[model samples]
Target: MELRLGISTCPNDTFIFMPIIHNFVDTSPFTFRVVLDDVEKLNGFAVKGILDVVKVSYGVVPKVKNKYNILKSGGALGYNCGPVVVSSGIFTVDELKGGKIAIPGENTTAFMIFKYFFGEDFDFIPMRFDKIITAVEEGKADAGILIHEGRFVYSNHGLNLLADLGELWEKKQSAPIPLGAILLTDKLKKEAKLLNNIIKSSIKFSRNNFEIVKPFVYRYTQQLDDDVIKKHIELFVNEYSLDVTPV
Candidate 1:
């Protein structure tokens, strides 16, 4: 038998998963296929039962709860911080009401963030962060919400940051944004132990083999240099949990 795993290639996740994926496959009992897609498509895959295990945004969890289960251990919570909100100029979330905001995808924490802060009533145009910067710069939208490399390159596009969505959540609730997380199918609890072990082992292997995976991260991330790649690895892939966390 086989299982399917879905995920995003963002640096935060990429760094964390690099080691985990390598270790998971090597040490786990179940063999599986891996699907790397943007957060939006990835969420759909698992939600539709097209894939067995996948990564999903924290926000999307409530919407698809009946169909999926949160893996708990590796969730990307705000922990008093998350991706910041940025734009071409000074603006508040309220200012963007009815305006255009560039975002990653419906299943992305960034998109949920935009929705959470803006109250699902605003207009958001989904696109890659890099493209979001260009769209905002060209005055296509009132502002933009960035994720991935966009965090590092916002200034390059002549845009200024307006907020840190994660930080904002921390300030409000004293916890992380509870961003993206690994998920299991609704009845896949049988995977709890295996999934947990695989993630733990993957992280262990990556810590020792970062040099080998650095190129993979860079290649997928628009050829980011070693320094940035190393930093990327450092930022995400925190302690892996093999259990579900409480709400």
Candidate 2:
């Protein structure tokens, strides 16, 4: 049977997952299929048992621990990971006090990151990444927290970057934010070995063949060019990618 795999188009954190996922489908060809969505909806999908495997934030592991397993990946940690806070009026995390902050979704790492620094008292309006920037720009929110491609595109919207969560994590913990992880749900627990092999092989393929696919990555993404996306790919892929870790 073909399994359902979910994808999000976020950059930085998700670069590795793309290649690893491609490898699985390319290698098995007939046994796997993918479902795509913004991370917001994807998290709910993951919770509802809609996907066999999905890319999820490290911060999200704790919330879904009983329902899913956090797959381990190499080179994923110690990498600079964080979302940028943006708004027309709120200039800093400090300015967000008691105001509504637009979050990607409740289960998203972006939402947790905002909550971590802003406290639970702050109100968060859930929106997808595609809509979050606009909501903040149009004054639909006091401010917004953005992740993935938003990191590269927020400035174009005339929104100001209030704070860098990755930078904050590093200063506080003296390590890069444990940004994301590839997840395999308990529903697929019996297929762990098969799944792990496919992911590993795909990661290997992407690293070895990145030059050939540079155009493809660029084509699918915005106008960032191959170099920038390539940098993110290198940062996110490889030894850091994984299939599972102990809680």
- TM-score per candidate, in order? 0.86, 0.81
Candidate 1 residue 143 Cα shift, in angstroms, is 1.1
Candidate 1 lDDT over residue span 140-178, tens digit each:
877877765566667766777788777776677665466
| Candidate 2, residue 171: how far the Cα is off, in Å | 2.5
lDDT of each: 0.67, 0.66
Error of 1 at 113 (Å): 3.0
| Prediction 2 global C-alpha lDDT | 0.66
Tens-digit per-residue lDDT, 92-169, candidate 2: 777777888888778877677666766777787888777888898788898888876676667888888888877777
Per-candidate clash tally:
13, 11
Evaluate model 2: give its TM-score.
Answer: 0.81
